[model samples]
Target: MKRKVFLSTTFKSLLFLLFSFIYTLLPLQAQQLYQPAEQLGELFEQVQLQSVFPDSKTFPDATPLASPDEILQAYQQQKDQPGFDLRTFVMNNFEMPPQPAADFRSDTSLTVIQHIEQLWPVLTRQPGNDAGSLIPLPNAYVVPGGRFREIYYWDSFFTMLGLQASGETELIQNMVDNFTHLINTTGHIPNGNRTYYLSRSQPPFYALMLRVLAQQKGKEILTNYAPALKKEYDFWMEGANTLNAANPAHRRVVRLPDGSILNRYWDDKPEPRPESYLEDVHLAQESGRNPEELYRHIRAAAESGWDFSSRWFSDANSLGTIHTTDIIPVDLNALLFHTEMTLAQMAEMQGNKAEAKRYEQRAKERQKALLKYAWNEADDFFYDYDFVKGTTTNIPTLAAVFPLYFCMAKRKHASAVAQKIEADFLKPGGVVTTLNRTGQQWDSPNGWAPLQWMTIQALRNYKHTRLADTIARNWTRRNIEVYQATGKLVEKYNVEDLTLEAGGGEYPNQDGFGWTNGVLLKLLTLHPELLQTTEQEAVLQR
Candidate 1:
C-alpha cells in the first residue's frame, strides 16, 4: 500500500515538473497565440480589403508557409517596389484552406441515413499537429463543414447526437475530451478552435454534451468531467460577485432589478472579428455609433450562435441596431440553469454537499430571474429582457422554447408557449425561426436544425406529443425533400418556402452541415415513420 502511494505521488510530481519546465520554455509571445490577421497586421488588412480571396475568412484560415517574421520582412522589402504583385506574394507565402468536399459524388441509390453514415468518415477529422491559426486537438473531432474547417464549441454537441445514433461512442468521447482540453488550456472553449475566436465562446453547451455522454455511459462520466463543468460555469459567471446596484452588468453576468443574476452574451475583445473583418468595418462605418460598442454587440451576437438575428436588434428590422450586450437572453440563461443543475448533480454524486447546495441555490435564483425578466404574462411566452432599457424586448422566436427544453417553464406557461408555436411559429415545412421576414437568416422563412430539435424536444417535455411529432415529421420530411433535390444536407432550411434554398447570411447556406445531419438522424431514429419509401425513391435519379 505504501509503495503504491509513493509511486502515485512520484508520478504526479514528475508531471508537475515537466509541465512547469515546458511552460517556462515557451516565451510570452509564443504562449499568447495570434491569428493570421494579428500576425500579418497590415498585410492581412490589405489582403482582405483588396478582395484577394473574395471571402474575408479565407486569409485568416490560411496556414503560413514560413514564420510571420520572415513573411513580414519580405513584405516590407518588396511592398514599396514598383509593380509589386500582392496576390502572387500571398499565394506564395500562405497555403490556402481547403474548400469543402464539393466534388465528392454521392451514391444515388442510398437513402439519407446511408448518406449520413458515409459522410461521417468524410466529416471526421483526425488529430493533427498544430498548424497556423488552427489549434490542434489532442483527439479527433467532427467539423461542421464548408468553410467551418474547425470544431465549433456548440455544434459538436448536436453533432454527437448523430454520432450516438450511429453508435460512434468513441468519437463522441474523443470530442468531449477535446472540449475538456480546451477548457483546461484556454479557460473556456472559444467559438471554434481558431485563435481569433479566443475572445468569445458560443452557448454554454459543455454541460449538455456531458449530460449526453453520461446518459450513454452512466453517472460516472459526470464525475470524470466535474472539473470541466465547474470551470465552464465559472467562466460564464466570472463577474457575478463584482456586480452591484451601481454596476449591474459585467461581461456575461447581469444582475437584475430584483437582485437575481442572469447571463447575457458578450465577447472580451472590442475589435472587428477577424473572420468578418470587412463586413464589420463597413457596418461600423455605416452605423455612426461608437465603433467599439457596435463591434462588441456584433461579437456578442456571434456568441449567441444566432448571428445577425432580429432577436438581438433593438429595431427588429435592422442589424445595425443590434444591442445584444444589453439584453438578457432567455436561451442563454436557461442553458446556464442546466449547467448549474448538472454541476449540482455531479457535486452530489461526488459527495460534496456544500458545493452541490451552492449550485442548487444558484439554479433556483436564475430560474426566478428568468421568470421575472424574460416571461411575458400578457404574451404568454418568453422574450429577452433589455436590462439597459428595463423592459422586455418582445421579439418572438424559437428561443422561447428553451425554458421548456430545460424543463424550467411552468406547466401553464408551457401550454401557452405551445399555443403560440402552433399559432405563429409552426410552418408547412417545419417551424419558421421567427415571425418577421427580416432579411437575417435567423428570422422568418428559415428553420434551423438546432432550433427544430430544441422545439420538438421542448414540446415533448411539456407532453405536447402531437405537436412534437408534427414538427418532427415536417422537419425530417423537409430535410429528405432537400436531400433528394440537392444530394446534400445543409445548415438551415427555408421552412416557409420549401422550393427555395435557405438564404440570408454573410456567407451562402453551407452544405455538409453537422447539426442538420445530427438532428435529422436522431429525429429519424425517434420517428422512423417519417422516412417514407416514396421519399427515398425520389432521389434515385440523382
Candidate 2:
C-alpha cells in the first residue's frame, strides 16, 4: 500500500515538472499576460464610469494582486453571475492604489527650506518591480506628489532645480539616467512612466535636464546624453519630411505654407484618456464636435502639460472648445530650438561636422519660422500660431517668456515682454500664469512655481535685473507666507488674492508639490534675504 502511494505521488510530481517546463517554453506574452488597461477592458471602463473611486485615476493605477490571466479568467466567469459585485471583484483581484503621502504630518517648527529637505525623502520613490499600469524605472526618483506618483517629464526638470540646491547630484544623475533609460527602452519618454501615457509625452525638457546635469558634472555630460537627446528630437520631428501642403500636419509635425516645419502637441490615441476616462467622455458628449476630434484635442492639450487652459481654448471660458493641436505653441518650438542647438554642440564635440551643421541649420530655420509665425509684432509678444486659422492666437500667456528664456527673443521683443509682465502679468505673489480668468488652473489668479522661475530667469536674461528682483521678492515672500499659514507648499498659489488658496482644476490643489519645493528652494538660495523676514512681515506682505 505504501509503495503504491509513493508511486502515485512520484507520477504527479513528474507531471507537474513537465507542465512547468512547457510553461517556460511558451511565448512571453502567453506566459505572462496583460497590460492593466487592455487586461481589465470592460472592468476598467465601468469602474471609472461608476466612480468606484472618487478620482478616476485610482482604478487605473491599482496593481493586480494575482496573475492577470487568473484575474481575467475569474472576472469573465463571475462578471455575468447574479448578484455580481464589480467593486468587490476588483478589491479581491487587485490592490487599491495607495494615497500619496497619506499619513505624513509636517513639523511646523522647522523652517520651510528645512521642511523641504525633510520632505525629499517622503516624495522620493524607490523603484520596484513593474505591476499594473505603473512602468518601472531602473532608479529611484522624486514624484511630484498627490496624484502624480510618477516622475513627470517636464516636472522633473524644475524638480531638479531644488535637488541641485539640496546638493543631491547623485539623485539628479539617477533621474537623468531613468529618462535616458526610458528613451532607450521605450523609444521616447512618455508624459510619465506609465503604459497609458505611452500615447503621448509632456513638453520636451530632456535637453534642459541634460544642461542642468552638465552644469553639475561637466560639459562631457551632454556628449554622454547626446544620443538620447537626438532620439527625443527625432521623436518630435518624426514626420517632418512627410509633411507637405497636401498633408500639412502629421502627428506632431506641421508644415507651414512657407514650407517651414514646426511641431505641435499630439497623441497617438484618439480615445478618452485612460486615467481621466469619464471626464473626457462627458466632455465629448457636450462638445458637439466630432468625438474623435475632441478626444484628440483634449489628449493633445494633456501632452502640452497644460491639461485645461484658456491658452488652448477657442473660447477662453469654455472647456469644450479646446483646440490644442490646431495651434503651434511658442514654448514647444522654443524648447525644440534649444534641443537642436544642443545637438549641434554635442555633434561638434564628437567631430560629426555634417550632423552638427544639419542640427545648426534646423535650429536656425526653426528660429526664423518661430519669429515669422508665432511672434505677434503688434503685441510685441510671442503667441501660438493658429495654423487652422492662418493667424496667431489672441491668447497671451506666460509662454511668451519662453523665447526670452531660450535667448531667441530680440532685444526689442525682450524689453516689450518685460514691460508686459510688469504692466499686466506680474502679481503680488508672483506672475499669473495668463491674463484670462477662465477658472482654469493655468490661467489668471493662479501662479505656479515653474512659471515664476521662468519669468524671472527670462527677465534676468534680458538684463531686466530690477524687474527680475521685484518678481523674485514677491514670489519668495508669497511662498513663505503660504508655508507659514498652511505648513505645506502647494502645487499652485493664488497670486492675485493672497488670502485665498489656489483653486481651479479637475482636482483640489495638491500639496507635497515637487516643482514648488524645487523652485522655492532655488529661489531662496538665490535671494537669501527673503528667508530673514519675520512671520508678521510675511503675513503683512499678503
Candidate 3:
C-alpha cells in the first residue's frame, strides 16, 4: 500500500511540470501569430482614415477605440463636434501601424515597403494651418507630444514642399500666412509656431518663406508681405555689425569679424538639448573640451546643422583652429547673401532700382568673400572658416552643397562636390544628412526631408541631372513603398538599416508632419522631369 501511494505522488508532480512548460510556450506562440495580423489590420484602418488624434492626455474625456467600429463611430462623433475641432480629436488617438515582423536581415524589399507604409499618413495631411490646431481633417501620420507640440522653423520649409505636391495649395498658403502673421505680430518669427520657440528663433527663413509664397501666389503677394518680411530681415541682421556696442540683456550677442551671432539650435538658457543629448555628450568627449567651449561649438554648429566631431578636428592643432567658440559658418553667410539678393530683387520689382543696385552690390561682395574664405582647395569642398583663427574646418559635409545653391562655388568645384555626395552620402533610401559613423543626428545614417530636398535642388542647379534623377528616384521610391506598406508618412528614416527610426528633434518624430508630407508630394510631382538634359544644359549656361 505504501509503495503504490509514493508512485502516485511522483506521477502528479510530473504532470504539473509538463503543464507549466506548455503555459509559457503558448503565449509566445500566440504573440507571434497575433501581432502581425493585428498590425496589418491597423494599417488597413489608417489607409481608410484621414487623420487620427494620438495625444490622449490632451483630450482625456474622449472615448477610446475598443474596436474597428468604435474608430469609425469616433470619426462620426468628431464630425459632429462643435467648432470644427477635428484636430483635437485626432491628436488624442492616432497610433502608427506596427513595424512589419519580417526578418530585416534577409528581405530588403520587405524592409523598404515597411518603411514607406509607415510614412503614409505623414504624406497625406494638409500642409498649412497649425499642426496642432482645431482643423477638421485627419493627419496622415502620428506625431509625438511634449517638445513636439509646435511647428518647427526649418522643418516647415520641407513640409511645405510636400504639401505643394499633394495638391494642397490652399493649405500651403495658410502655412505661409501663419508665418507672416507671426512676423507681423512679433518682431521675430518664433523658432517654431509654438510657445516653446518663442524664446529664440532658428535660421532666418523669412525671405525664403516670402520667396516660396511668391512662387505659389504670384509676385504681387510680396507687396502685401513686404513690411513683415523687412521686419524679419532686420531681426536677423540685428546686432550683425554691433560687436563693440552694449546691447539689451535679452538680445543675442556675437563677436564681430567672426560674424558669430546667437543662431539656431540654442535656447535662452543652458538646459540640456532635447533632440541631441547623445551627440552633444560625444562631441564633448571627442573634443576633450570644456562645457563652455562645447556650448559655443554647439551654437556655431547650429548655424549649419552639421554638429559632430570628425577626422578634421581629430588633431589638436587643427582643432585649435576650429572655432568651437563664437564662429561663423559659410552656409549662414551664403543664406544671408541670398536673403540680400532676394531683398534686392524685391526692391527692383517695387521700382526701387537704385536701392536694388546697392543691395545687389552688397550681395556680390559677400559672395566674393564667402568663396575666397570658405572654399578649401586642398579638401576640394567649402568649409566653415573661422575668421578669428583664420582657418577653415576641413570636414566635408552637406554645407558644402549650399554654395552651389547660391552660385557661390564655381562650376568646377560644384561638379566635384556633387560627385563626392554621390559616392559618400548617397544611401539606398536617400542622401543622408551626413555620414552616420560620427554618431551625430545630422550626420550619416540619418536622412531628413529638408536635406534631401536641398541636395536634389542643388544637383539640379549644378546641371548634374543624372545624379539628381538617381537621388530623386531613390527617395520617391522609398517614400511610396513605405506609404503603401504602413499607410502613413514619418519625419525621418534610418538610412543604415533602411528602416524607420524615431525622428530626432525636441520631441519624438511627429507624424501628420506638415513638411514631410508637403515635400514628398512636391518631389513626386517635380523630380521626374528635373533630370532632363535640357535642364542640365540650362544649369551649365547659367
Query: How big is the positional error of residue 110 in model 2, measured in Å on the Cα after superposition?
Result: 1.0
Q: TM-score for each prediction?
A: 0.94, 0.92, 0.63
Q: By TM-score, is 2 or 3 better? A: 2
- Candidate 2: residue 436 Cα off by (Å): 1.4
Worst 10 residues of 3 by lDDT: 1-10
Runs of candidate 1 exceeding 4 Å displacement: 1-32, 100-102, 533-542
Local error of candidate 1 at residue 274 (angstroms)? 0.5
The better candidate by lDDT, 1 or 2, is 1
Give the Å shift of residue 383 in candidate 1: 0.1
With a 3 Å backbone cut-off (N, CA, C), the pairs that clash in candidate 1 are: none
Q: Name model 2 segments beyond 4 Å from true.
A: 1-34, 534-536, 539-542
Error of 2 at 306 (Å): 0.5
Query: What's the CA error at residue 492 for candidate 2, in Å?
Result: 0.8
- Candidate number of the best lDDT: 1
Instruction: Pick out the ten consecutive residues of candidate 1 with the lowest summed lDDT.
Output: 1-10
lDDT of 3: 0.53
